[model samples]
Target: MSLALEFVSTVRADRSGPVDTLADVDGLTSWARAHAAGPGFTASEEARQETVRLRQAVRALFARAVAPEPPSRADLPDLPPFKEALALVNATALAAPTAPQLSWDDKPVLVIAPAAETDEPTRLRARLATAAVEFLAGPEVALLRTCPAPRCVLYFVKEHPRQEWCSTACGNRARAARHYREHKK
Candidate 1:
């Protein structure tokens, strides 16, 4: 899966509320390790906080993008979190030495590899941020969708024509709700 999608999947469903995977530094570290293709990332308290902030900003941006209408300039300015997240993403990309390199392999023919620098945490963030920017700016932004299941806060890219839910469980839940409503009547 793309980094943007993986980052968005850090949140899960709950009976009471949404469950955030990056609720702490350890969760953030686990997520980084799983998604990051580069060097081993050392998660710090600061990095975890920044990741949480960025996640919220990205969620807000996704919500706006999937809305029925565009937000006004006044509305945009009020989103200080989004602004700060964008700054961090831009700065990290600018500070990076070089983009990931491609190398030829006997089995796969070609492979893209990350830089061999020690700054794993920064690289991971930059890569994820870049993916998010690309996803939001590209034409596929239209595919960005939130799950329709009740109490579900997850987001997903619509990969198939009939794909309406994020997972089979969500689809089942929607079906069950529809059935209950019909039977109650």
Candidate 2:
């Protein structure tokens, strides 16, 4: 999965209700660490808010990317307008500028990386937004699907011809619900 997809998975629809995994500084810190490809970060109050805003924007865009298909239930109430979401992600991605550098030992490979002096929070947001933009434009967007299990609010890239729900647990939940409905009827 792309970093953007994992970032969006931070929010989930649980049995109790919708859950914002990045609900506070601690949550944000852990999520950043887990997702960080370069270096880990501890989120600040302002950083948390900004990160959440970016997440919302990405989710909103993802909702549209999977158009004609229902979006994650967790994102339903918080999705921003398509244009607004686009602007937010683009701005965030541009906030901390990156430059391309070539690294070669055996072969030459160029990498686009954020400026060294950029703060942790800003770098985090930029990386996330960049990943989201790439993911949305990439071919995998055609494979994204929102899980249909009872109370599921997760999206997944269909891995195979037969894949359905986002996870085994969600598939089980959906099966159970279908069984219950059939038996009840």
Candidate 3:
């Protein structure tokens, strides 16, 4: 999965309701470190706000990419216009000066390197936005599906021809609900 998919999954569906894992600075900091966007990145309140906005933008784009299929209910409230979301994500990805640069160990490796002057938060945002842009442009976006299982608000790439729900747990839940409905009547 792309970091973008994982990032978008942060706004999750709970039994009670939608939950935002990045609702606070500490959460954002932990997420950043976990994603290796920056190992020691400490998110400021400003960075938290910016990151959330970027997430919204990415979610909006993902919603558009999976057109005609409803998007994650969790993201519905914050989604901006498709054009606006596209602009925001592209802008964020362009904020840092990054280029394909060569790095060599035993074998030569090509890497996209952002400028040394860019701060951690900015670089983190750029990396995430770039990944989202790439995901949206790539063929995998066509396989994106919003989980149809009741109370599920996640998206997943359809890995198999028979795949429907986001996970086996969701599939089981959906089947159980269907069985209950059928027998109750």
- Give RMSD to native, each candidate: 4.7, 1.8, 1.4
Write model 2 residue lDDT over 51-117, tens digit each, in one string. Answer: 9999999999999988898888886887889899999999999888999989999999999766667
Over 1-185, each residue of candidate 3 has an lDDT whose tens digit, in order, gives: 77989999988877888888899999999998998475778999999999999999999988887879888888687698988999999999888868889899999999978765788999999889989989988999999999989888888999999999899999999999999999995
- Between candidates 1 and 3, the lDDT winner: 3
For model 2 the TM-score comes to 0.92
Candidate 2 ranges beyond 4 A from true positions: 37-40, 104-109
Q: Which residue segments of model 1 deviate by more than 4 Å?
A: 37-39, 69-85, 95-97, 100-118
lDDT (10s digit) by residue, model 1, range 11-41: 7667776677888877888778777643366
Error of 1 at 87 (Å): 4.0
| CA lDDT, candidate 2, residue 118 | 80
Error of 3 at 104 (Å): 3.2
Name the lDDT value of residue 103 in candidate 1: 64
**Backbone N/Cα/C clashes per model:** 0, 0, 0
Colliding pairs, model 2: none
Local distance difference test values of all predictions, in order: 0.69, 0.89, 0.89
The best-first sequence of candidates by lDDT reads: 2, 3, 1
What local lDDT score does residue 88 receive in model 1, on the 0 to 100 scale? 62
TM-score of 1: 0.76
- List the lowest-lDDT window of 10 residues for candidate 3: 32-41
